[model samples]
Target: MSSPPVSAPPALEVTGLSHSFGRRKALDDVGFTIPQGRFTVLLGQNGAGKTTLFNLVTRLYSNRSGSIEIMGVDLRARPTVALAKLGVVFQLRTVDLDLSVKQNLLYHAGLHGLSRVQAQARIQAELDRLSLAERANDKVRQLSGGQVRRVEIARALLHKPRLLLLDEPTVGLDIGSRQTIVDHVRQLCATDGLGVLWATHLIDEVRADDAVILLHQGRVLAAGDGATLCAKAEVKDLGQAFTKLTEARAA
Candidate 1:
């Protein structure tokens, strides 16, 4: 006898997504999926519809033309369920300078409706992961840029989100800090079974094994693993492959 179908779900699913503002197309037919326990990079340059997609997924801008599903919950039809399983760290700094690291995280925990006891435990656990347990009482302004960024990550995870979304997470950090943040996130996928949708234009951030969705001029130019995209572009490296594919699209 045939076995019953399993109900496995991707971390995120977007289909036929399109958005615009007064005839200016911000996104056009964007679609992709980020699998659980993997890091997927949303690669696009400035004004390439990356942020627009993020806004739609987070429901900051409702998607009128398509669908967004998070771990099987549709954003439009079940925003509460979808959002509860999703965590976001935008490109801009979100930490309050006056608040201590623990306070900042606790505040987020409270917002997520975690009780004080539950919030304290979760706060300690996440801080420990980022090596910020010792500095929990330190004000955000006293931490380095990289440290602050790590705190933001911990805050995002405070709600115990299954899918994490980060936009240009490494912007303005030095090479060391960037590597640290990147490696830490990849570790989360491997260790915690977290699904990541990391949006960035930086070519170096994409490993050869990572899944990639290339967005260009409000459209998805390509979607697949890095090796697949490289093969499609007929280039040996991601940097060269990106240029080749984008140049072709521009032609």
Candidate 2:
């Protein structure tokens, strides 16, 4: 007899995810599911609540009322356990300027309960993958902005998390550094089967077949593969397609 097909669980899922401060709603009834092993990018304008959603997913701000699941685990019911299975690189640089690259990575691993020996092995492996092995002992302050960002990436992967969250990760980097980070992320997602949510405003970083969610005015304006979505409108690029979609919806 032929074997039955296997179904993969969603890497990230959210339902009725609404949040507000005073009179303004940052996220309103937003819901979406990201399949396993895809590089999903969330596109939005300023104040569209992309950061707010990231915060909720990372459990930085408690969801007053909503459901969030990461790697099939409900974040609310088991916040700590759920978060441990995920890796995150925020918009801001978080590495210690005074610490050596290796030392910073070791500290991150320790927080995830990785033993010194195990963490060291993992850190070494990641540094090698990033081609930063030669500079492991160099202080972060001595490295260029691009090199420091690589350290943060290495730190996030120290525990081998199933999901990776990058919030505007290349926001302020130069063109070369931005391209480097984008390329590395693409490779990681494809090779390691790590589900990625890359929040950003740059459309060039989006791949033709990658999944994407468009946020406008705190609501999901659209969601699907970026190229597929643009094709439907017969547009050449994301920026134009987004403008057409939102304008048509308004009319």
Q: Per-residue error at 57 for model 2, in Å?
A: 0.5
- Top candidate (TM-score): 1
- The C-alpha stretches of model 2 lying farther than 4 A from their native spots are 1-6, 232-234, 248-251
Query: How many clashing residue pairs, candidate 2?
Result: 0
| Alpha-carbon local distance difference test for all models | 0.92, 0.87
lDDT of 1 at 226: 92
Worst 10 residues of 1 by lDDT: 1-10
Candidate 1 lDDT (Cα, 0 to 1): 0.92
Best by lDDT: 1
Tens digits of lDDT, candidate 2, 1-251: 12212466677898989999889999999999876678899988777899999899999998988799988899999998899989999888999999999899889998999999999899989999999999999999999988888889899999988789999998878999999998998888878888889998888888878898988778888899977779866798877887787677668
Q: How much is 194 displaced in model 2, in angstroms?
A: 0.3
**Estimated TM-score for each candidate:** 0.96, 0.94
